[model samples]
Target chain A: MIERRIQSGVGPKTGHKNEKGVGCLNIIVCIKQVPSTSNVEVDPVTGVLRRDGIKSKMNPYDLFALEQAFLLREQYGGTVAALSMGPNQAMDVLYEALYMGADSAVLASDRRFAGADVLATSYTLAQCVRKMGKYDLIVCGKQTTDGDTGQVGPEMAEWLEIPHACNAISIESFSEGAFTVKVNMDHSIYTLKIEAPCLITVDKDVNTPRLPSYLRRKRAGNAQISVWSMDDLADQAESHYGLSGSPTQVERIFPPEAHDDRECFKGSGEELADRLYSLLRQKKRI
Target chain B: MAHIEVNQKKVTPEIAERLSSVCPFGALVVGEKGLSIESGCRLCGLCLKADKDGVLTLVKDEPTVEVVKSSSRGIAVLAECMGNQVHPITLELLGKALEMAAPTGQPVFVVVIGWKVSSAVESLRCYGADKIYVYDDRSLEHFEPLRYASCVEDFVRKVRPSVVMAGATSMGRSVAPRIAARFRTGITADCTGLALREDGDLVQTRPAFGGNIMAQIVTPRTRPQLCTVRYRVFDAAQKREGPTSQVEVMEEPDGLEKAGACILEVLAKPKEPDISEAEVIVAVGRGVKDEAGLHLVRKLADILGAQLACTRPMVENGWFDPRRQIGLSGRTVKPKLIITIGVSGAVQFAAGMDKSEFIISINNDPEASIFNISHLGLVGDLYEVLPAFIEKVGREEPVR
Candidate 1:
């Protein structure tokens, strides 16, 4: 188990400061591995998602988030670390992150952290961040395709007692300890500035993710990727890490009832509209 | 927080082995000391159920006792708004709350947090709220996530309502979870349906695991059962003239202006016609080739006096305004007539428009999933079918 310490002094290795006099930034991009296809099945008895034969890939939204982190790292001299919480196989996404541009990777994997809901998942991620070391900023995808809650990043920010913004369209400006961003809030986009040690969940389709370099893949094949279990985290309580920590209870999950009743009308456009208008009239909708 | 206790003296190696299999979350570990409860323990009592000998007991964690203060009555609705006017979804939530309130013999309360919302009180009362709590402050003119969350959290802590409902809008999504986190309570987000059980539990039904299934979630032990209902999921509350709801002005929290982030500016997005309220809507999907195809869609909509909408991809491609997009994440429209052109109905898109009174889907792909929900399915090229439909409709009904 790796012990986490919050270093107070600046290290000689990254003593370079920006023009605004801020120390070298340490950015952590949180990613998750999700089933590639949407055809996942759930066990009715256990109420757990099944992933036996399904292939996994880095969450599609996280790609934009990593792209944003890479851009920030390029503009400012900083070290970017890829962090994730999942099973051992999640290292595949971490390895991909290494080939892309992340300086390092860490996976918080343990059997004890399984079946976590949004709250427990965010708490586990918050503990993982605390263990990974000091970070100036944390980046995450707007939401995971599998979970689709869009709540983890903000919840993690809450757990860490930091500020966070969701659906960020672009980083408008950045100084030493703060950055201004444009956030898309459905109807309106608001420009907001958040201080360092904050989190931002990037909107998908806003950035073009870079391709993994084959040269880097070959050279960094043996890159040291830290793997941490529950023992490694700051919060070692088993109850706070998994299903027990979750407050919501799922009584049942069943396939949505499908209605197969439909009518096929093969005719010219005029006949179709005539039929449609008559049908609406019959239903008294018009 | 949860409390799990095991009678170590009664636990045998076999019992420890059996305990590991009981927690689907793997919260129980079969250590050398027999069995130990982990942080992941939900206090579900499933382990006790599996162990017939009653060697285990699960209880609420005592350390966080203040979080469970006192159970209060009434159903509270978080009134969301666009400037001074209340959003329709808030009324929809109030409508559902009133329905649940009817059987429970509980009053309905509306909580409005904004500046200069006195004009909204009459509407809230008309919508069946027995009381209206308004938190009026200048700092709240624009949404700051944490500040808004803290204010609502303080209000909830003070009132201790049995249930709290919010619209699943962007602001609602941001605020509801924070309040839930503050209270350490369970929140069912984007719920499509809600019900009050005989035991006064709120059963929140929502699509889970990527819309593959609808899961019925319940906050059985938690007070102020929090839920965010999707817009248009429930009918709006009817307005009736009667005794006005009691109005109480709430003071803003002490640190309301000291949140971590600052809103640099609040620029209003371009005003577009709301398709959600349109009587007839003509929507196109990814199958449309380019701007020319979109022109045809526009012409058809013009002839039919319908609003133009599209599937999510069109919005992602910058072809349509997000306001004109129809899907689970976008606006839910239940128009009288909806014509989907070249749209293969994905489940996400179907969830938004399934309730349309009549749907006519025209696509070259006969096996398009949109056909399943469409009342009139035309299997042909939209390029061919759209122009023909426009010309026919124009000829049949000349402009007055």
Candidate 2:
């Protein structure tokens, strides 16, 4: 067992994250495929995307980040490489990006890449980004819908030795290589400028994503998609990907077990309203 | 399926417990039970992979934080759009902001179209907006962010508001960070509630680190506090008689710069479950067991005519659609009737599905927090409880 602790000052410094985006900006965005829902109804028998006619889609927030990238392209005219770590099907988002106007896309798909945790994910993505060449800017959603782990983007930036903002709301500019932007942290607004190749994870409100033009959508669907497996990304210790590489493992799954005396108050408006108010007050959810 | 973070070092159980306290899941026990696997884990598996010595295992764990927040100034809601075809959240924000504002001196002001815009600014008066700042313009049609930010900046400068409220809509969200940055203010995303502090500070509360933890943050320094409320978290402001009009309008952004940020195309969402508006939801996680069990719940849903939703597992296993899953990775639901079967109320999973009108939880764990929020807590296996429910309902009951 390794005994360690985060230094008191090890947390992100209180300053602008985009302070250095003043130079020629090179950016790479790492994305992932996540279960859009935590309530993913699984088959006790076979774990699979139930096509029993049920449906699913990409995480909505990721699309907004992609949209922000497209807008950035319109502004700075830089290369936007969409990097995602997932199964072969994860290409759906990559292709979606291409259709929306990404310069290129890379798929980190491999058996070994399966079940990688945030640390492993960031490690693998940093390596993949290194392989994808250089960039001044990197973007992603604050957190994937399923994984809900907002650590990857910041973790990736830390591993890559670049500054990062975990909750970026607006990107003011990306000039010279220094990127200037704003973030919502704790309760303060931070206007920061950082050197390029920095990482940013934005919320869905960052931008209204443009619908994929039918033409580009078709082109991306037909483009020669590049798939990079664990072997393809890096020849690291086999303990680096999936369950073997991951430190945390999901031991078991169970539904929430609770027995609140959730007795409903059925009555007239005043009574119900009183009941509702008391309930909210009791739960402290008001 | 766990994604554990390796801080390049291991943390002591004490610190782990502290981090866990601030974490969405419950505190780490350090060794033994907390090590191998947790007791209240939602099966997110993110923290699990953060280590390698098998220090942390993904089990059903408790959410470190609470969903609601507290502050001195009460809830600071930034109401963006609230006229014509107003989103229910707009009024809900108004009602909540009014409630939160009443206890404190924080006035709930509604931000409308910037100067010279055509949105119905007058209609907002009925919803509890103490003052209105309408920044209007043609570019504001689709909520041009640049213009929105510029307008908010102007309003914040003039008002010096204790808390600047905004909806978590695409427009409000984009505008929030930029505005907050302009003032160097701290902004919380998709917050479910807001409150004030004894020191007259705003506590911006929302689900943090995913749905596992609900956190309350305060801007101890920045002025004109900011908070972005998640949609549908509160009830709409009931309309009042006479007039809900006669409000104020704000100055528009600089013309040329505002017109420059163009929106090439904006498409409305076209889908089902519209999880955003569902009044009745039956969210199922691992408690429903496997895909076959999901079918049973679906049958029950069909019998009750309720939308069937799942947790992350069903999607990971391809047993359900990602859209239908509830939690941090999924949609937030505040249904009228939310029946849980076998689902452990992990904080992340609980964050998105906790706001139901009537919550009925069916899990074997007698101490699960789901009972804390359930309208009716059933301490038994869902398999046993569900059949009885189906019989009672007879068939799926539509909203006839």
- Among these predictions, the greatest lDDT belongs to 1
Q: Which segments of candidate 1 are over 4 A away from where they belong?
A: A1-23, A40-53, A258-274, A280-286, B1-72, B286-299, B313-323, B362-372, B375-395
Q: What is the interface RMSD of each candidate, in Å?
A: 6.8, 14.6
lDDT of 1: 0.76
List the RMSD of every prediction in angstroms: 7.2, 14.5
DockQ of each: 0.30, 0.07
Candidate 1 per-residue C-alpha lDDT over B154-246 given as tens digits, one digit per residue, 9 for 90 to 100: 777788798889887778777776666565567887787789876667888877655345678887666778888778778889887874689
Per-candidate TM-scores read 0.81, 0.55
Chain B only: TM-score of model 2: 0.74
How does chain B score by TM in each prediction?
0.76, 0.74
Q: lDDT score, residue B127, model 1?
A: 69
Give a tens-digit lDDT track for model 1, residues A1-286.
2122211111112122367746467889999987665543444455444433456789888999999998888787688999998877789999999999889999987756755677777888888887777787899997786666677787777666677788899976667677799998857889998777788889877889998999989888889889998898877877676656666777776544444666887766656656655664476444
Candidate 2, superposed: residue stretches over 4 Å from native: A1-25, A30-137, A142-260, A263-286, B1-77, B114-119, B209-213, B244-246, B255-260, B391-400
The CAPRI category of model 2 is: incorrect
